[model samples]
Target: MPLIVFCGIPGSGKTTRALQIKEYLEQKHKCQVVHLNEEILQMEKKEVYKDFQAEKFARGFLRSNVEKNIAGNTVVILDSLNYIKGYRYELFCLARAAQTQHCVIYCECDPQLAKENNSKNANNFTEEMLADYNNRLEIPIPKNRWDSPLFHLRSKEETPFEEIANVLLYQAKKSKDPVSTAPEIKFEINFLQELDLRVQSVIDELVQKQQESIQSNVITFSDCTEKLMINKQISLIELKKIKQEYLKITKHNPPKRIEDIKNFFIIYLQKVVERF
Candidate 1:
């Protein structure tokens, strides 16, 4: 449950450091590392970096992948120019919600040298783009909880593999041990029961609405076909199982708002229904 984020300019050796960390974690710790660099490279091959919207889409895609991967006991390394503080905050929220540990590695580099390095690379950014990115970069501060445990490294500095490994591995072990003040499992029984009821209620309402639409002859044949597909895919037992799985997932990271809870139930139901 370790998320290592790399933050730096394009030519700041962020990728190199990420690779070094990935190698060390895999070799020394025998840990699986999900490198976002490969994903970014795939996106680059698709030219997803050409447009701002595409870049945002790529980030969201990568974030979802990270979220899914972090559900298990693997290490995630996000190798990118994580320049936006808000984006980093979003990542922090994801890590917190998933009960994972995360830290940022900032690769500090001189502008002139960075530009010179960029000039030597084939996939180099234009001087104008690099300047724009630099202007837009929001450096992570230690005062922010999300940016705590921040590790700083100069462009030419050797990667401190052992130090980082110890911090992540040992801290993860400490966190895994249950806290003395942890709430009693029985205390959450009532909340889980209520959540289960709410999930069932939402599914019941959706089925009723679909039946009403079909009986009222308001839906076309194609719509009926789609409804039938969903109905055939989501059996009552399967729906109940899905609800149970959702409850288990949310037990640790429950939705905070009433609307969010309802929305979560509906969205999860839709996802499960669509899978078939």
Candidate 2:
């Protein structure tokens, strides 16, 4: 796993830089990046991390995602305001558990400039959020015990996008290992049954609403539901709870028609069960 955690205050250009790094990794190295914040918000159907408690849930979600991506060769970039020290430590533990290489890219920018930029952006946080985050945020200090290299970037004068991108590309090249040779298998009956139930539950909830696709073959509800399945490490009971919610909301299952989704679930379950 290749995990890059960004640490900075609100509006410190963390997201911007993370996206840039993601693009660079994808285009140059042919690596796929799983972004945490965008994936989680759309998946949960609600903002689960508005406060500190929610943040912990989000961190737990990230840990699982990093672990999942470790099996693949792609680099996962965690783009968020990792301002809390404890949260940073939790991320370190996650990387270690996954046995993946990790790095920290500190998006250092002038506070006033970040505030100005945030004020001008559409989804930017308001004054209250900036104040709360700034006041309570504990900055990270570089260390070696974590076994990951940390790069501190002071933005305004030196927006380290290109330089950092180069560094990340170099790291990716040096760390290249042979591609995974695991055998592929078809999904079994039991596995598809479970996935079918879960998808049916989500479709039941999303039936009435018009949802838009954020990426190809990847709708918002799909992303969210997949995250719940992939990241939360949810148990069978929790999945049953989702189905219960669907039953409570719709009082019936949503009719399934598309051959593609049907085929996907069938194949998806096969792959998952085989991996197990």
Candidate 3:
């Protein structure tokens, strides 16, 4: 799992560099790259620039997608301003949790030239907004674990494809020793409580719906006996523990169907019992 994060102000050619790297990795290294920026933009119904809530939503969406991708053997290019060091640290923690390799690419550009470039785009940032972001920008430092393996590039310079590929591919491979160790999964106590509530909510909804359908004679009781197994087998304490592991794999990739959710619960119960 390789996550390449792009950090730069608007009009700093971050997207261009990200795309070039994506193409090089896909073509040369035969690596799968998920361009998260494109996906986020596609999901947006309105303009996100200058809108705090929209930007926050987009970032959350991007994070979920990145989480889902990093769980697999693929490269994820996070094409965004990434001006916040705290956010970068969060991503660094996620990569660590997923046992993936990650790096940061900072596209350094002249402020005046960047504004000039921004003027050419229809969705360009306003001068005030650009200045605000610049003032708040927390440049990544090489010494930071979240920003290590950082690659600095000029706005218009060609991306060093070979160097980037080597860092992500060969260097990452070399770092992985023979002894296989599992990544430690942790969750906040309140978050586990919240997940339990969510699971209970889903169970409650399904049970109510099943009762309604049964009363209408649309379905018989026998049809739901196996489905109700989740309610019977799920213990709050056991659920809290299993849910920690369950969410590690599924928080970003939730089940789409009710049956699948029930199956997941059943499978979780089986695994818990098997451990004892």
Give candidates' CA RMSD values in order.
Answer: 10.4, 15.9, 14.3
lDDT of 1 by residue, 1-276 (tens): 888888887788887788889998999889998888634546652355555657667667777888888878799898887776656766776786666688889999998888988787666677877887788788988765557679989977888898888767788676664556655444354676677766676667555656565544222231111222243424567767887877876676576543345555554554444344
lDDT of 2 by residue, 68-164 (tens): 7755767777777777554565566556444456778777767788899778766666677777778777666674333247788877545455555
> Per-prediction count of colliding residue pairs?
0, 3, 0
Sorted on TM-score, best first, the list reads 1, 3, 2
Q: Please, what is the TM-score per model?
A: 0.63, 0.54, 0.62
Cα lDDT of model 2 overall? 0.56
The models' CA-based lDDT, in order, is 0.70, 0.56, 0.68
Error of 3 at 267 (Å): 36
The deviation in Å at residue 6 for candidate 3 is 0.4
TM-score winner among the candidates? 1
* Lowest summed lDDT window (length 10), candidate 2: 225-234
Better of 1 and 3 by lDDT: 1
TM-score of 2: 0.54
Residue 18 alpha-carbon offset, candidate 1, angstroms: 0.7
The sequence of per-residue lDDT tens digits that candidate 3 reaches over residues 1-276 is 888999988779887788888898999889988887743457532366557657666667677788988878789899988886756766776776665678999999999988998787665778987888888788998976678889989976778889888888887776554335733335444554555555555445545665455444221222232232222333456656665666665453344433344444443444343233
